[model samples]
Target: MTPDEISTYEETLGVLGDIDHRVVERVLREAGWSPCGAGDWAVALRAPDGRAAARISPFDLVAPYTVALYREAAHTRQVPRLFAHRRLVGGGDLQIMEWLEPVDADEAAGFHRALAAREPEVAELADVVRRVHERGRRDQPWFAPKLDDNPDNIMRNADGRLVAADLFGADGPRLYAAVVDDPHLVVTTIPEPERRFMTDIPLTNTGPWPPEVRAAMHESLTTADTTHQA
Candidate 1:
């Protein structure tokens, strides 16, 4: 990314507009963490000593939906336990989540490839993915899991186990707007090369993506074009 764009991303990452500083401090103190890094919409904080950390984001609609959708994932330890903290009064819904240690792309790909062998480890991870999708709601705006999520979002921690990260994606007009607004800044700023292994990722085992996901993608881009025209 250009220096200007990086600056913009840093500025916008986890930017709390008009949010009270007290809330940020509370989350940091209570979570026993300090700011370490960030993503498009969330701030990642590291623990004082260990590899553990907390990923905190301002109250957002996606947080609640993610927590609900990953019920089985949380149960099966496919994902870090999502904590809904109302401790910040009037600060919307602050999400303080456990941050799992991330294994490099090659390591994650190794495990994913093992799935082709029907390996138990990969099977368990696949099962967690299955559960996540099973709980997904088609009627909901964010039903297109294939488009929103990817293998790069999966992490191999210290234990060599697979964990899902960046689990919240609400597909709708808002998501469309974000992509339309800036394809690089919001969508592809970071290179996700490991995604090639996931051509057959979706459990559906279909050759291509679901019809609905393709339709949603096309609609989002088209809507953006139409909006620009007007």
Candidate 2:
């Protein structure tokens, strides 16, 4: 791999820590995703045009979980529909989902302003979150969402409907905790199911505000005794 490839591949490793590196390489080879871009949390790959994307990450449960969270998970009419997923088969998880267009720049900017302000708090987060956990299990429910409500995730097309985009991100567990920690991220509520769930599970998967989020991310990604991040 070239330096660029190595850099992106390392970001992939950052998201899939604990999994053997060789296995991840094989999975990527078989999956045949054309590389898009990657950051600290995960790597982005897409199938040929007109096909859904398949993102590989450490968060095995989030994809199916998101599918179940949204009421219209089946229809891609409004949001990106998760077509399928592989739950950590061979030490890696693959999420197959609809390819959504980028959110409108103006609309995204407006939403970002709202995020920075945490204005007009929405109470719906509790319900939405509850639904995700409820459907996240094999016997019961499903989940898709990047924890951060970065306006980039909320997109729209010609029809003016909200397009659920950028449903991939950094560490799954940390992302979850970040959402729970911030009342402004999604919705605010005193009663908490995820909080209780987090405590109940001994070993389970687990932010910061906009500008602060980046800083905190840098802090977490910082490697000791080295200027580079992991």
Total clashing pairs for each candidate: 1, 13
TM-score of each: 0.49, 0.44
**Which tens-of-lDDT digit does each residue in 170-193 have in candidate 2?**
244544455435433312221222
**Candidate 1's residue-wise lDDT over 1-230, tens digit each?**
23553344234324544343245546466756677665443456665554445544442334545555445556656565554333122322344444566677776566556543547755664565545545554434434454244456667555555766654454434443454455333223212221111112222222345667656554555454455546
Q: Model 2 Cα displacement at 138 (Å)?
A: 16
Candidate 1 off by > 4 Å: 1-22, 25-32, 49-51, 68-71, 74-77, 81-93, 97-99, 111-119, 147-152, 158-160, 172-230
Off by over 4 Å in 2: 1-32, 59-61, 70-72, 90-92, 109-130, 133-147, 156-161, 165-230
By TM-score, the best candidate is 1
**Total backbone clashes of model 1?**
1
Query: What's the distance in Å from true for residue 215, model 2?
Result: 23
